[model samples]
Target: MKTESLSQLLSFLDASPTPFHAVDALRNRLNAFGFEELLEQESWKIHPGSKYFVVRGDTSIAAWIQGTESPSVTGFRLIGAHTDSPNLRIKPQPDLNQHGYLQFGVEVYGGALLSSWADRDLSLGWNDLPEKQNRKNRRTLFFIILNRF
Candidate 1:
């Protein structure tokens, strides 16, 4: 695919609410640059000079910029990043009010600012599940107000 700056990627990622969304968006953009999506359920074999991508459920994804070399060729370029971010996530439940206020049980992950978790837009994506449509899915979007009060 046409190489884009990380800033471009970050903007794209920021626009996606879920990993499913991000991968879909990326696959589209990459299509303009000769990137082909690969299905995980099918047996895999790649000839040299083929650039391919694979998606896992709604979350994880991986892509490789293949040159005229085999896996055993010992040289390749790989750009790696995660499609998911942190938010108070768990299975659905009943009764969110523990006190007189709406409350959420949260567990923080990565370099997130705890104070900013509230009152801001957040994109979603993560490492779980596997689906064909998810290979072409992107859901939600976030607009964060980094500072409040």
Candidate 2:
């Protein structure tokens, strides 16, 4: 059971290249487990035994389980986590050429072990949504992986 859980975690990390992607991944799992999405701008109808989530700017998310017991007597349970991997990020106008060799301008986003990344299969992920759906849809994620430096 531990091995299965660890494998799932590694898979999740591999799939989530960015914080936004990570949250979306979590949202997908929550949905599979019967959780529903809640919009912050709208009125809420929370009930016991129901699960719901709300995302802020596609970068952060909050999820909860509404228990049957009143919070005044039985307090709520809260679990929190943050996702941030020390990795490279593509800069705006990412294309570059050095000595006639094409390259992508990448900036390190966190405290990454730069030496560990040598010869690894690397990829870039992106999400493109229409302006109108920026407040709703999340099916526009895409990735572009470069095989060579």
Candidate 3:
């Protein structure tokens, strides 16, 4: 059982490239475990002994179980974790011609070792969300892993 759980965890980590992917993965797992999704924009009609989750910006997720105990007497249990991975975002005008080679302007967004990225294939993930919808319900997603040079 432990080995199977470890393998599943490994697979989850392997599949999660961006924060959005990670949140989506968690949502799937929670759904499999009988958790329902809740939208922040809508009014919540929470009931006891029910499990629900909410996502924000496709990067943050919060899940809860409505136990029988009242909030004034018994508090809730919170298990928090974060996924921090290096990301590079392309600038508005990313097209560039450097030394007769096409290049894109990029800015790193996390604690990443630029030196370590040298000579390594880089995978990039991006999502475009509509103005009305939060990042949780992204309209389009692009998962791209650059070929090794």
Please rank every candidate by TM-score, starting with the best: 3, 2, 1
- Please write out the lDDT profile of model 3 over residues 1-149, one tens digit for every residue: 99999999999997688888888889889999999999989999999999999988778899999998898898767799985587677888899998999998998878878898788887878677777746444556668888986
Return whichever of 2 and 3 wins on TM-score.
3
lDDT of 1 by residue, 1-149 (tens): 34567778678866566556676677777787887878898988886778788877646777877678555677656678887665545434523786688754556555767687567654333344337667454444333333445
lDDT of 1: 0.64
Per-residue lDDT tens digits for candidate 2, residues 1-149, read 99999999999987798887898898899899999999888999988988899988787889888888899999877888886678888888988889999988888888999898887877778777668847455657887787985
RMSD of each: 5.7, 2.6, 2.8
| Per-prediction TM-score to the true structure, in the order listed | 0.59, 0.80, 0.82
Sliding window of 10 residues with minimal summed lDDT for model 3: 133-142
Comparing 1 and 2 on TM-score, the stronger one = 2
C-alpha lDDT of residue 125 in model 2 = 82
Candidate 1 lDDT for residue 20: 62
